[model samples]
Target chain A: MSEVAVSIEHVSKKFRLYHERNQSIKSAVMRGRRSVHEDFWALKDVGFEVPVGSTFGLIGSNGSGKSTLLKCLAKIYYPETGSITYNGKIAALLEVGSGFHPELSGRENIFLNGSILGMSKKEITAKFDEIVDFSGVEKFIDQPVKNYSSGMYVRLGFSVAINVNPDILVVDEVLAVGDTEFQAKCAQKFRDFKNQGRTVILVSHSMTSVREMCDSAAWLSHGELVKVGPADETIDAYLDSLPGASAA
Target chain B: MRYLKEVLASRELLANLTLREIRGQYKRTIFGQLWSLVNPLASMLVYTLVFAFILRVEPEAGDPSGLDIFAVWLLCGLLPFAFFSNVVQQGMGSILGNVGLVQKVYFARIVLPLSKVGSVGYNWLFEMGVLVVVLVIFGAFVWPWLPLVVVTMVLLAIFAAGIALMLAVANVHFRDTQYFVSIIMQIWMYLTPIIYPISLVAVQSDKYGGLFGTSVTILDVYRINPLERFVAVFRQLLYDNRWPDPQDFLLCAIWALAAFTVGLWIFRRSEKGLAEAL
Candidate 1:
């Protein structure tokens, strides 16, 4: 029997969009609640399992619900009906350091971002040096993160998030934040995680990354799971099925 | 209750976010956090000048003697009212303002609103310190019921949190709610007895002339206006130095419950969509 890290059983998420921007007295009086919404499902009936120590890649076009499914697995959004049970701690780099304050120093951001990621103060203190070292921002640790380049900011965020030693890591196309060299380093880290038998759920549009890193691949199309299997075969099938694959 | 407990369990994140807010607002400013007290102090100065000197508004004829009675009266009403209004308006933007943060974590969503309570509490505490200094300077220290003022401020905070939670939820799905909040606050301020005693509007209507552009006391409008009782409670206890009528607390309890329930319901309903929208 496979040791499962995460189990997703028939999950779905729906969103309501409003045509009117504001619900003020004037709008309510004049427009009378302007034609609000028909439901839009970001995900529907998605079911999957990531066994312990396996690297699973999710590939889909934008707005195809790959990221939404990852979010549901991360518990960022609860499923409408079905349940997701996670066996161990999951650290998601959904958006690298989205909470970074403009005026706070990089050192301060490490603590803040670490805590925001659910790390205790004691954990931060213990791993502080390693995080700064990994970020390669020791020279600018005291400088406010706002002054850092986007690449530098992502390095700091990724370093902190990866160092959390989470059992399950959820990465959402954020690995492209830094330069190619940094991207290579992140990929190497993923390899190490894979070698050490940690579970990873990666959402990316890059077919190359999916083939290089993932043991298995899943293709999501319009909130539905379209394909799942071994990385090479599944990715080959997905690419073959694309609109202009034969012509290209 | 289970949700509240879950939020409480994430108290560290709430405190961290609140600290971020307090520091972020004043981080690079010259005076830093001292500005919290400076703002309310400045408003007190202007109101004291306008009413005591320009309009020559006086308390009822048989009011007791005190240090610079105008300042006492103005502060007595303004302090609690400002605290509540500031918390509410500031909190309207709190959840939406920090939508970015909420998108990243699995922490309790209530942390967003509760953090507003913390930051506003910080501001109110600073304002309270200034109030104490003012009392000392004006020799208004002998009031026997001062402890109850603490209770009043706490109630105002609960009331503020309740309203803030409602606004935070509403503002997320509806952008215009924030703008409407500003207009509502302006009108609500006038309806509240912060600038002038509600008793003045209640008892001496004929003497004051279409008082405040109406032939009625704010007390007469209490049923429609929620702030009436909250302001009346503070005015009674702080300005008159007596226990607030218990009826005021009852009304506050109702407002608190209503705002909490509606706000929580809206937030829970809307929260699932926050990630995509943000």
Candidate 2:
């Protein structure tokens, strides 16, 4: 792609699987070592480029390192081997309301969560009403979020992450949150995001949605790249490779 | 230096997080923020009863101010030490307490501990304000020395933040750090001469010559504790209404800067691995 939003070249991530979850100094001293751990490679030389303004989907089976790769893109985890370079601001929706303090009111958490997501006070202020309106929790904004139903909590979180308005949006499986009406609203928001020429990268298990929503896709299996191509063809290949899939 | 710059750029987030802490601390309580004052007052009463009344421990009257009240004298040292302890304890847990946030979001991680300091420091100011008012009512001329008290308080806060930052990172790898630090803090409180007077140690040191027949006097080793110097400076400024000893002031400044620099260095080095370790 001529105008790339994100370029991931030869990225590899390693995780340490500790034999014993020994989180104590005494045990460490007694054992004469920190802990016994085996290095687990979560992502191995995975490389892909996301084009500007395009919706890119990552499809993989469970434990396929898609989440780890998404976290690396979000800057939450640093890759052990390679670098991920991106232009402009990037925001990640790894989990809805991850930073919300349950005791704070919804209005306060909006500001708290927004700032944690890298929006300035002025930016949050400008988008405050839009966020509350989108979440449809304006009536209970003053009440502490501990009283919020799980759906309302997730909706508010998703709204703030969406309104952050970054050059690149990194989303995990959080797309499946909230009711059908709210999900429809989110679909329209994503459409608007695409129309505004912003990059969107998501990880999802629903092959149908991946085929419908993504312009291009990448398939990962066991910490390696399986294929990167048009969304329909890649999803087809991914499905066909499954143990019991009938050839179309 | 790049990390410091990033933290400064995100000062707004720091402010918001601090506000969240201050607001959330007293939520759902019947007394609300009033408990802040009540907590110190209750401790003051208990310490006064045990040390001043029953044990017959007597602290000399304030030199220039002639403020002989034991309760007032006790508070000047007690308040600062309490603030220091709160900052260290709370800041040490900031990262571990917010595991969900750390794992999911990307921000300057130092903000977590620094915000703890800010929130507790805010409460410290209010507590000190009440103490100053009480001192004035008790005929102590604390007006001229008020600025110096503020300076000393800032230094103590920096020192506590540094220690807290170090412990926060340690606690992530070893869960026992918190419990261990709590025991150490209790012993440290008594060691700092908060409830008793430094004069007691000085008198004993003079009578015995030195500790265990060594060249080093007991008083020499007692002064080595940074909190001792902090409490001495606070007592000199607010209780005695005078400038602190130049040596004590210099030592406090050194401790504050050294602790903060070292704490920031440790926190930055471990910031990346924090998400995974948790």
Candidate 3:
């Protein structure tokens, strides 16, 4: 059997940019003059692979489609062309405000967000208190999340996200919101996942963290893959090609 | 087939999302979920005072409807219309509102619109409770037939859900589907025998000598509108304490099935583009 955890083959995605969204009644009526939409490709035939049990890093500039690629792997954004295959159950923490109804209490959000990631209610019930404890918001867990601080909110979100026991995990740059202690905890969790021989895909702009945590890395620029292979070497090439970092 | 399996696999998520939607609507308010009943009652009072009293428009009489109170008769049509309208209006906006979840998670896309349907159904339950109280107060309550509302609501919700799913996908791209929906629903309300009875259309059709130069009566043509049959069922069962034609149930079934299957087809066809489009 193939040991690949995720394989992407020439995948692409496009978006429509509306010149005028025409959200109002008046604008819709006035829009009869011309078409107000344009198609923009966000990913242009990008592809890569992550072997089982390895942490893979996806690095790129802001518009280089790093997050877009992660979304495809997470099955949030369907590829316009080509295909992506995954070998096991997948979970993703795409970004903050991952649709935790703000009015819901932190405890309720744990169940809500967990189920959204495909966890069953019985599974969530089994680990409910453990999740709240890991988030370190035990006292405030019963209160509506709208009342929590941004850090508390993200901490609770990250806590619920990381609790899922999927065979393959996808993480965006949501860890940037966490404090140093929680970041270290996440780093420890990453090492534990690697120890258990599960796949982890991480998307980050920070080359240092990518080199530190990932066994292999893929670099993308403008929705196209520019490099893939050993983490340290890929980061080195990506940095050397940058406008200023190479000269420095 | 794929969407069904997806929904079945993520049934727990659907339930959770539906609960979230139901709770979120009442969370911050002092009245909390009671607002569901309060909302429809408030609208019922305003229309009752205005349409039932001020205008003194004569309701179609000589039918089996026991209640001569204009408000009560109006409600039989109005409440069902209200339920249908609420589902469509809210269901259409489901996808746009949940772009946060839609763009983050991997699960059945149908659950998004269906969750809105579920929440509105929850509110409808409470509204029905208030309706029973109102009917008892007016002495028009039929104890045995009350459970029949459940049957009509299920069919109406399915039809509404089908339309909502289509609108949900469309609104994600056009951004104006909901706005257009508001205007269209108003025109629809006038056509569906909500304020005026179906007999009004029948009388006019007879007067006009059958529209389009055919002998077919206007009520027959209007009955082709799915909502007209649904409201008629509500009127017969709840307003008149009489049984709806069993054959009319077949029409309700056909419309419900057609809406559901077509809606799911459009949803699946558009599902792949949803994330990119958003």
What's the TM-score of every candidate structure? 0.88, 0.98, 0.93
Instruction: Go through the candidates in order and give the C-alpha RMSD of each one to the true structure.
Output: 3.8, 1.3, 2.6
Tens-place lDDT per residue, model 1, B130-247, is 7766665665543665677777667677778878877877777667888888989888888776777665665655455554777764445543566777767766655555566788
lDDT of 3 by residue, A15-92 (tens): 768786665546767866434789888889988888999999999889998888888888877777999999998888
State the DockQ, from 0 to 1, for candidate 3.
0.63
lDDT of 3 by residue, B1-278 (tens): 76677779988988999999988887768988887777666777887787767866667642464677767777778877888888899888888887777778777888888898899888887777677677778776567777777888899999999999888888887777888899999899988987766766777877877668777777777888999888888877777777887877778878998998899899999987787667
Candidate 1, superposed: residue stretches over 4 Å from native: A15-40, A78-81, A243-248, B60-65, B142-147, B204-220, B223-226, B232-242, B249-258, B276-278
Query: How does residue B56 of candidate 3 score in lDDT?
Result: 65
Output DockQ, candidate 1. 0.47
Best by TM-score: 2
DockQ of each: 0.47, 0.82, 0.63
lDDT of 1 by residue, A1-248 (tens): 38999888888888766666444556666876655677888888888887899999998778899877887877787778788888998888888886788898998788788878888878999999989887888999999888999889889999999988899999988878688888888888899998988999999888888898999888889999998888998888888878998752
Model 1 earns a TM-score of: 0.88
Worst 10 residues of 2 chain B by lDDT: B205-214
Residue A108 CA error for candidate 2 (Å)?
1.1
Residue B111 lDDT (model 3) = 87
Best by DockQ: 2
